[model samples]
Target chain A: MMPVEAFLRQDAEAVRPAPALVKRGWRKLLFGDVASSLLTVLISLCALWAVPRVLDWAVFDAVWRGNGQACFDAGACWAFLGAKWPLILFGIYPPDQQWRPIVVVLAFLAITLWSLPERNWTRATATGWLVVIVSSLLLMGGDTLGLQPVPTGDWGGLPITILLTVLSLTIGFPFGILLALGRRSEDRMMRWLSVGFIEIVRGLPLLTMLFIAAILLPLMLPDGVTFDNLSRALVALTFYSAAYLAEVIRGGLQSLPKGQEEAARALGLGRLATLRFIILPQAIHAVIPPLTNTVVVVVKNTSLVLVVGLFDLLSAGRSALTDPDWPSPYIETYILVGFVYFVICFGISRYSLWLEHKLSAGVQR
Target chain B: MARPSPARESTASASTGWRIAQVAIVLSLVGLFAWLASNTAQNLHSRGIMVGFDFLWRGARFPIAESLLPYDPTDSFGWAFVVGLGNTLYITLLVIVLSTALGVVVGVARRSSHPFASGLSAVFVDTCRNMPIVVQLLFWYAVVAFGLPDTDHASHPLPGVWFTDRGLYFPRLHLDGPLLPGVFVLVVGLGWAWTVRRRDQRRRTETGRSPHAGRKIVAGTLVAAVLVAATTGLRPSLEYATLGRFNYMGGVTLTPEFVAILVGLTVYSTAFAAEIIRGGLDAVPRGQWEAARAIGLSEHQTLRLIVLPQAMRLIIPPMTSQYINIMKNSTLALVVGYPELNFITATTINQTGQALEGVGILMAIFLAISLGASWLMNLYNQKLGLVTR
Candidate 1:
């Protein structure tokens, strides 16, 4: 026979527990959240009401397609954007030869998508630069491809922005790796020179450097030795990005364990061989995330070329808004430009995150 | 036959090679140096431009929008440059303090037990981190300078202050006499409080009683400073911004430029800071917190006395680096015409035609600022590190 206390304890333990939907302290939290949500909705509704009232007078009842004062209403006169999208995107490239930038864009897209596959990546890196060089020369110079020669001054808009980013990264990243290695070297002179160059580049703003290259470099260079404005901007971007990329690569190098280097040495590999065969591969792999971040930063910074009067995307958008036909589409044009930048940056980040997961898979074991 | 010691033989061989390499390196360096110097000299001569520091002390003819110290268009270039440097430091320090505080809070919130707080923090991080800083800067500047209420409508009284596109005009503190004595007294009170708290903590360890030292120190400092202020006879008054015929008067006005820059910098950097803080918090071992609780210390005491002290070493290095980043990013102020160091230097270059000199000075200033920050924080990092060791 069991005692009463034992019976009671057994009874308590015997019943299977029901899972509670809400936690013990959740009521107050839920109530507070609901109240705040309601207030937010009320405020938002008021704003929405006011916005549409204005929009009705400006957009809904306003002229849809017209020139001059015929399109002069309060809301966005987006008709001008429709008219200028081609010119804004293709810039002053000869209308007949507009196919050049279009082909360049298509090639870039194909290469980028194909390179995302691991098997294609090696050839992608080598062939990608070759394609870039060939296509860029075709698009910019035009004489090489039996096309009409279009000076860089005629280049503007989306094509120019993309070209600047690609050229900068392609030139800068390899140089950045060299700088990182030099800075880490035991050789005193190499290390100091590398360090000095990296610091000087990193310390100045890209805008300041771009400004100097635009205004001052011209004076420094003798007549007929002058580089194109686009070339100077590309140079500034490359140097600036290389300094930042070197720092990121240095982070990757520092993250590597001493054992890796020691093991390479034990294998009787010389300094160059060890760096090429063993060290760099692992360091670069470890630094993939920061390298992606640097790329994104570089992409955003391409807009600064606008300050030096290059007609990049931002400048293109600004140009679209300035048309006497659509004087008030500034907000809409800016939003569109912002959307483009957001899409590119967000895509890169997602891809990098995916790569991180893929690479980190076996480390746990 | 003669035999040499191993050390002497090795030294002889090493010295021979070393001397050859040294001579080659030196010769190369000297050659390179001579080439660069002569080329620069020849280039300058061809351009008919004489290079010297004489322009720095010479009177400058330029109008600057904002200067921290007294300056005019007639002021020397050196004076103008100094004022710009001071302004840069001021903005950097202010941004660092504000962003750090906001970042710590957001970081802590991200790790909160509550779901809403964590979700909010995650959204903030994603939105701010992914967006281009330049776009954000332009957006904020437009919202403030163009989108906000016009200056005409802003004169309507709203809680004793006027808010407008021009600025937030509020009552400014007016002092008839120097408040230095009051400040000195307050500082002394703080110092005394620290000493007393340390003494009380030591006494508690020996005597085995609850110290309540923190409360005692707070009480002592508050009492001491308030009493000193009362006795010091400091005449303080309020000067509210007045609506005038032409402009708002009698107030310390904040320009829209300052507001936009502050907002942009704070919002951008805080997202990064939040990530770093969350990382620091995660790096602390869970066992430490459990151990503190096991000893019967309350949660607050455990957090303050155990978790935070241990986590600080990890927290500080990233935090200081973020501070340095924000300092550099403040140069973005030039985009909006904020007369910061870069903007001033840009103007100087335009006027002086000393592009190389101006750029060199700007780079040097930034490098010094970054290195100085790293050095100062390294001292604290060392101190915190010793605690764990």
Candidate 2:
């Protein structure tokens, strides 16, 4: 074969026209591709015009202290939020006892951040979560360690939201797994019962369930017996979360092949042992993305407790608006609360995406 | 085989024991439910609370801000519920149409070659989807109620439409003359167009060549309809809103609550819908796109005839769930005082102290709506499903 350089040298000598003055580099970035470049410029112009006005109102011109009297019409009244932040964060909890909820919230954030990395998700981490959860509940519930008892009704704001979500998921997770198992069981009655429960709960809105928990559950109780509002709401949340979690788990269960179960059985493994040692570990691992999505949903749904008159983060924000002392800064309060919710939900979503990437990569390997 | 033969008696006993256990479990559950029911009855009796739904026939004296059906303060609770159901359905249907349109536009934009368009869509989807929906609803309500001009100086962005803190008012159409004849003509023209298209398709299939009759049929239909309207002297006019001392008159008005809930639900649901649509579009294999291009089809033609049909199959199932979600989320309208089914039921429960009956009605209505939506979507899905030998 002829040397490749000989062929190239002949072509190179034939003619290298001056390289055309192509629009490369910055010109290409801005205007080389007419349609897209024009659109990008247009959008950038709009953003440039809009962002400064928003930043001016939200920060530079905002009122940062003392009753918002100095705030201009065009600016945010951050001072209103500064005054009401405690009320919004702790609801009507006693001023001295507010430190407890602060600690509880910190503990929740710490545990959540600790659990974010997959390598940290060991049995010890699970135990740590349990410890944190119980201690947080105790801290909020009080009545121990020389602390005054704070009734559940007195609990409010971010702590309540986090506690409701975490507690319900803790209770709902195992129950959901059982429901999923029952839904896929060989026994006809078990399957039908599971399906019925799941559908009935799934069909109704969480608001109506909360109403039943608040008003009707007590009515059903015997005379002179009562259920606390928080407990009832917790029960409702558990059942509601379980229905959705069951569906997610069932999706994972369905994706598993029958041979896995058969192999376990052929090895003389019993049903429970096969599920615990073989089937569940793989199925749960397969479903981490969806499970995390459900967790995000539960976090959002915790706001529905507001409908039942519980003082969740949303309800606290609304309550903050009712103070005659600082009435006009509703937007500022809403923005702050919304930011808090956005942070948590957005974090969970990002984590779920990362987990999905990791899991799919593992599958390829 | 020999081992099995030796355990016949033991096997019979074991089977009987299993049956006994199942029976015991079932009976115990039944007993527990019966006890709960009797306990509820006793509690009601002791508390002197009515257990029946007859209170539904009594008058509901509360005024609803928005209703699709005729409603009065003296209307029966049952009638009030019907009106609430009407409002819920109206908002739900409107939101579904608007969100689907917005979602398609944004979803397509998300895949645009332009970096900015895709980024803009991504920000919209993320911001709307991650925020708590109640906060969005409240934000919209606050903006509408507090941001808009006062009633005395209402903004008239258009000649006949007015926006005030109270609501938005727009001209309603009134067919003043010969409406029936014009509609009849229009229907007939549409039917004729359908037949023409069918015949053209048949001819193309049989002979492998046919004229494109679509434009001609559409033009013919328009001409016929216009001629009929002209001959019949059909005139449609807008009935403009007039400022009354206390409120607007003559034209339709949408209350701030209604506007807030409608816009909130539409915007929020559109975010999820856009993501679903983008996923569906992405799921269509790139090979399909290349093949369509190889056949010398234009980009628009490729999308319309090849890509979208396949994407729809992937989109419809998730889109159906999103539709159900929008319907369920409509209950949030209660927060803004839109007098939807949930609000009405909550009021009835509070007024009558019939929480059981009121919640039961709410559950039944929602279940029926969800099931109906699911059934319709399933039928449509079956139509789109792959057919195989």
Candidate 3:
């Protein structure tokens, strides 16, 4: 597939010397000019002062394993993590049924990895996701296939985080597409309604929306009509995500050339057919990068569920600290939970970068 | 600027279908609203709740730990909301200014020719950006309140700055007298400095001659400060936070909650905003820099005269959204128990048992602020936006 000239350029790039450049780099950074040299010295001194203290606290003096007693006076009580991993990861979900969450987490992760590349996205991928979603819900909310029924009240940890994200996105994505379409449509009423919903929701913080869900939704519902806290929070998140996703989708819709739709119309295709066959595929592909970023933001925002007393991952970790064995490894637990979030967010963000690079490469070619 | 083409005329059947679609959407929306409204009315009636703003005028009967304005436990709920709003805006404003400055530094650092600076900044940006803001807030709160030493063993980092479990305390200068006249003169002096800087900049651009504008600004500020103090007390004074029997007794203190939220927001937002700024700077073509060099302009002058203004066209739009984000994120102070708008709303709901009104007020205030801020930014953005051919 590659031309000889391009192959030679690639070979030339691969053959560029790095070790010598690195050697010269150090000298250039350390003593390029008087200002640079002074800056290098100042930065070196600060790092020297800070890094050792951090390492001493985080690793050198840290307790790796044992009971909580040895960790009392030690730097980081990482052993506390060993004692608390179950409760932290699976939350108050029943101890014996913990395997269900494990399976659910793995399934979600596997499907996510499989579907990450655009080329792998197929109708089968979509069907697989729907099946995985149904099974995960049935897995989490048991009372099926001879499994014991678990209440929604005890849901927590990574499973809850994954559920909130997946459920909100699934429910919000189509609604967002509708809103984006309406906003650009010729109808005045549809445009106004779509604009109003998007602006009002986007104008407030998610916490406030969650507050409405937590504190106000019950009061607003009719007598004897109720939903659990998690469901209420899901509704809030769905609306919030819908509004945000609409703007992003609108950006994609706008980027699409008008000629695409005009040509479809000239071919005697109806409006809906034009949208489905000609417009959506290209528009969605164009905005894949931003869509992944929105996923990152949602994953992080799920931690705010702690505010409403739901046991998401961060909340589950905090609850794990209630054990009498570990006195205070607050820092260690936060570091671990934060590390988990960092990994997920950072992974998705890097994927978005890769996707952007690939998509733009096609455009340039 | 116009739409590229008009659609072909719709057939009669297509027009009828469109009308039916419109009717279906309108009917569903109206029916849904009606159902929800009825449910709300029934729920409120059965619960014996007096759904209104009457409770807002009653005594708040609670203490706000801190405020920019004076407040007491006897303050009304409305006044409590005001105090909370004031604190929210104050922190948001401080974060906006501080983070923007920090973002600029980090951004420029990322572009530094020195590999060390660039690599270090990249690390800083990655770590801060990846972690959730709530975890950062909690970590910082723990560090300040528990990880650090108690007041008895407070670390005196600077002459009058103490890091203690209770808070961080820095020496503050207290002024006494007619605040109005002093503030008036201060504003006037600022205008004077602005004109001086603008005129100096114009002259420098016109003649390509270096001027000591920085020194002039510093001298001007010093002169203005002296004038301010002279108008107020005519006496230069210092106030230090001293160790009392139980705790620090003077100067200004940033409580653990305040410090935690402030640091968390500033660092987190700076990472994001810095990336925006870095991208803007990078997007300026390499040709611009080489061209400036060919024209014999120094690095600083080239950056000032050429690259930055072009980068501004890219920077302003994203920067506007970042600022709006700061306003919204300030509500996260609620988690640390810092009394911001969300915290006040929570308290009001608990006190009044009127969840609807409390949340309604919260939404109204936020909608106003978010909408108003973006409107102003749009004006500025329009003024600075690129003119297309």
Chain A TM-score per model, please list them: 0.85, 0.88, 0.92
Measured with C-alpha atoms, the lDDT of residue B287 in candidate 2 is 95
Best by TM-score: 3
lDDT for position B248 in model 3: 97
Q: Pick out the ten consecutive residues of candidate 1 chain B with the lowest summed lDDT.
A: B5-14
Ten-residue region with minimum lDDT total, candidate 2 chain A? A7-16
lDDT of 2 by residue, A1-365 (tens): 88788756544356668988864565555565777677777888999998997898788877787664575464788888878889898898888999999999999899889998889989999999999999988888788866899988888999999989999999999989989998997667778989988988888888778877887777776777887777888999999999999999999999999999989988999867999999999999999999999988898888888888889998988888886665467677778888899999998999999999998998996
Per-residue lDDT for A152 in model 2? Answer: 88
**Which has the greatest DockQ?**
3
Query: Residue A180 deviation, candidate 1, in Å?
Result: 2.2
Better of 2 and 3 by DockQ: 3
For model 2, give the RMSD to the true fold.
4.7
lDDT of 3 by residue, A1-365 (tens): 77677746543345655565445567876798998999899899999999999999889999999987898777888899988998888899999999999999999999999999878889999999999999999889998866899888898899999999999998999999999998997777888999999999999999888988887677667778788878988998999889989999999999999999989988999888999999998998899999999998888888888888889999999999888877778888898899999999999999999999999999996
Tens-digit lDDT track for model 1 on A127-159? Answer: 876867676767667877677888888877778
Name the TM-score of candidate 1.
0.83
In candidate 3, stretches whose alpha carbon ends up further than 4 angstroms from where it belongs are A1-24, B1-14, B176-233
lDDT of 1 by residue, B1-389 (tens): 77774343342344566668757967997887776566656666776766776778978788877656788989898888888888777787888888889998889878865555667788888777776666667667765675556766785566558877777688888777666777787787778778877888898899987667667767777776666666777777888887787667777777778777888888989898889888887888999889999999998899899988777777888888788778777877777778887788778877776766777777778878777777788787676575433
Better of 1 and 2 by lDDT: 2
TM-scores for candidates 1 onward, in order = 0.83, 0.91, 0.92
Writing each residue's lDDT as its tens digit, candidate 3 over B311-339 gives 98999889988988898889999888899
How far is A3's C-alpha from truth in model 2 (Å)? 30
